[model samples]
Target: MGVVAAERIKLTSTRSPWWCAALVIVLGLGIGILMAVLSNDTEATQGTDPFILSATTATGGVSGFGVMIVMIMAALTVTTEYRFGVIRTTFQAIPNRAKVISVKAAVVAVVAAVVVAIAAFGAFFLAKGIAGSGPTIRMGLDEATWRVLYGVVLYAALAAVLAVAVGALLRQTAAAIALVVLWPLVIEQLFLLFGDIGKDIYVWLPFANINHFLSAHGSTTADFHWGPWGGLVYFVVFTAIVFAISLGLVNKRDA
Candidate 1:
C-alpha cells in the first residue's frame, strides 16, 4: 500500500500526468464533438444503433485515441524510472522487486480506469448535448448502453496495463513507447491492408477487439466478430499473457 501511495504521489507531483489528462480530455471531447457534428441523421437508424453512436462519440470514434494517452502514461511509469536511475532507489526501498512491479501495475490500473471513465462519460454527454433531438440522443440506460460504457472503461484500463507490461519487458522508454504506439497506429493498420487474411487477423488485435466491445451490434465478418463479452475476454487474456511475460523478465533481470 505504501509503495502504491508513493507511486501515486510521484505521478501527481509530475506535470506529465496532468498534461496527459488534458490531452485525453481535449481529444475525447474535441473529436467527439466533431463526430457528432459531422454524423448524418441516417446513422441513428437501427442498424447503426444510436446508443453505439453516442458511445463512439464519447470514446472519440472506434480508434481509441484517448487510450493512446493512457498507454503513454503506462510506458512512462516504469521507463521513466529507468531513464532517471530511480529504479535502483525504488528497488532499495522495496526489496521484493516483483512486489514493486505488481504495485506499480495496480496503481496504473486504478488510475487509468478512473481517468478513462471520466473521459468517456464527458465525451458521451457532450455528444448527447450536441446531438439534441437528433437520432443520437441519449437513450435511457439499457443493457446494451451500459455494456458499451463498461467495455470502454475496461478497454482503457487494459491498454494501460498492457503498455506497462511492454515497458517492463523493454526497459527503454523510447522503445516501449514506439512499440505500443506504432503497433496500433501503423503496424495494425498496415497489416489490415493485406486483403482478407489481414482483415481476419486484424479483428483479433487489441484495439479491434475493443472496437467490437463498444459496438452494440456484432461484426458482419463471421470470422472477425467475437461479440462484446467475448472480445473483452480476448483482450483480458492477451493483456495477461503480456503481463506474465513482463513479470518473468523483471524477475530474471537486474533493475
Candidate 2:
C-alpha cells in the first residue's frame, strides 16, 4: 500500500504524463469528430441514408494513436527515473525492487485504463451524436459495440504494463519509446509486406491480436486460430511473460 501510494505520487508529480493524457483526449475526441464529419459528408455526397457508425470506426483514434501515447507515457515513467538516478533512491527506500516495479506497473496501468475508458466512451458517443440520426445510426449497445468500447481500455492497461517492462529492461527513454511505438505502428504492419508468410506471422503478432480483439469485426485478414477472447488471452500471456522477464532482470541487475 505504501509502495502504491509512492508510485502514484511519483507519476502525478511529473508533467509528461499529464501532457500525454491531454494529447490522448484531444486525439481521441478530435479524430472522432473528424471521422464523424467526414462520414456525414460522405453520406450527403452519396445521397444515401446516414451510414451506421461502427464502434471500430468511431473509436479509431482512441484505440490507435491515443493508446500509443499512453504506452509512451508509461514507459517514460520508468525511463525518466533511471535517467535521473531516482530509481536508485527508490530501490534503496523500498529494498524490494520487484515490488516497486510491480506497484509502478499497477499504478500506471490503472491510471491508463481509467483515462482510456473515458476517452473511448467519449469518442463513441460524441461521434454518434455528431454523425446525427438515421435508421442505421441508432447507437445500439450490441455485443460488438460494447467490445470495441471496452476493448480499448483493456488494451491500454495491458500495453502500459508492457511499456513499463520495456522501459525497465532498456532503461533508456528513446529506445523504450521507439520499441513500444514502432513495434505496433510500424514493425507489426511491416510484416504484411512479406506476402503469404507475413500474413501467417501477422496472425501471431501481439498488436495484431489486440487489433483483432478491439475490432468490430476482426481487423486482420490473416487467419487466427482463436477468436477475440483468445486473442486477448494471448496478449495477456505475452505481456505477463515480458513483465516477468523484466522483474527477473531488475532484481538481478543494478538499479
Candidate 3:
C-alpha cells in the first residue's frame, strides 16, 4: 500500500535510524574481531565444547548491549515525536492516526529486524575470518551455526518492538528508555534479590530471559522456555504483550 511504502520511506529517510543500523553492524563485527584476536591463542578447554565458547565469546559479552540500544532506538523513534510535536503533523497528514501508528510500528519493527539479521550475518563472517582455521567449526548453509547466526538479529529486532510497546505507555523517549533499560538491570535485580520467588519470578523477566537464547544451559522453569527457540519466543511474547498494551493507549490518546 502507498501508506506502508510512505511510512517506510519516512522511517528510513531519518539519519539516526541509518546510523543506528550502521552502528549495529560495526559494533557487532568489531566485537567479533576483538574476541577472535584476544581469544586466538587460547585453545578450547579440554572437555568443554569449543563451539560454546566460540559462540559466547567471539559473539562476546556485547550481545546484551545491542538489545538495549535497539530498544532505546525504538523507544526514541516513536516517543520522540510526541515531545517534538511531530505527531500532530504526522496525524494531520495521514488523518487515519490509528492506521498511521500501526503502520509505523510495523514498519519500524520489520526494518529493525532486517537490519539486525544482516548485521548478525556480517558479524558472523567477520568473526569467522578473524578466527581463521584455528579450532573452528564448519560454516555452511545447513549448519547449527545458522541458529546462532539468525538468533542475534531476531533477538535485537524483537527488543525494539518490545521497547516500542513500552514507549507507548510513557510517550516520552527519555523516560521510556530509562524505564525500559533500568527495569531489567536495576529493578529486576532488586526484586530478584528478595527470595526463592526471585529466581522463579525473575526467570520470566522479559529482556533478561532473552539471553536464554545464547545459553547452552537451560531454563530454570517450564513457563520460561520455548526450547532451543526460547529466546525468540520470549522476545515475541514480550513484544506482543507490549504492543497490545500500546494499541490500547494509541486508541485512547489523541495522537
The digit string of per-residue lDDT tens for model 2 on 186-212 reads 999999999999999999999999898
User: Clashing pairs in model 1?
Assistant: none
Give the clash count for model 2: 0
Model 2 regions more than 4 Å off: 43-52, 135-138
Please write out the lDDT profile of model 3 over residues 131-198, one tens digit for every residue: 66644433334434666666666776667777777777899877898997898668877755767777
For residue 245, what is the lDDT in candidate 2?
100
Off by over 4 Å in 1: 40-52, 61-63, 135-140, 220-222
Alpha carbon lDDT at 42, candidate 1: 67
Please give the lDDT score for candidate 2: 0.89
| Model 3, position 162: C-alpha lDDT score | 75
Could you list the CA RMSD of all candidates, in the order they appear?
3.2, 2.2, 3.5
lDDT over C-alpha atoms for residue 244 of model 3: 80
Per-residue lDDT for 76-99 in model 1, tens only?
999999889898999898888878
By TM-score, highest first, what's the ranking? 2, 1, 3
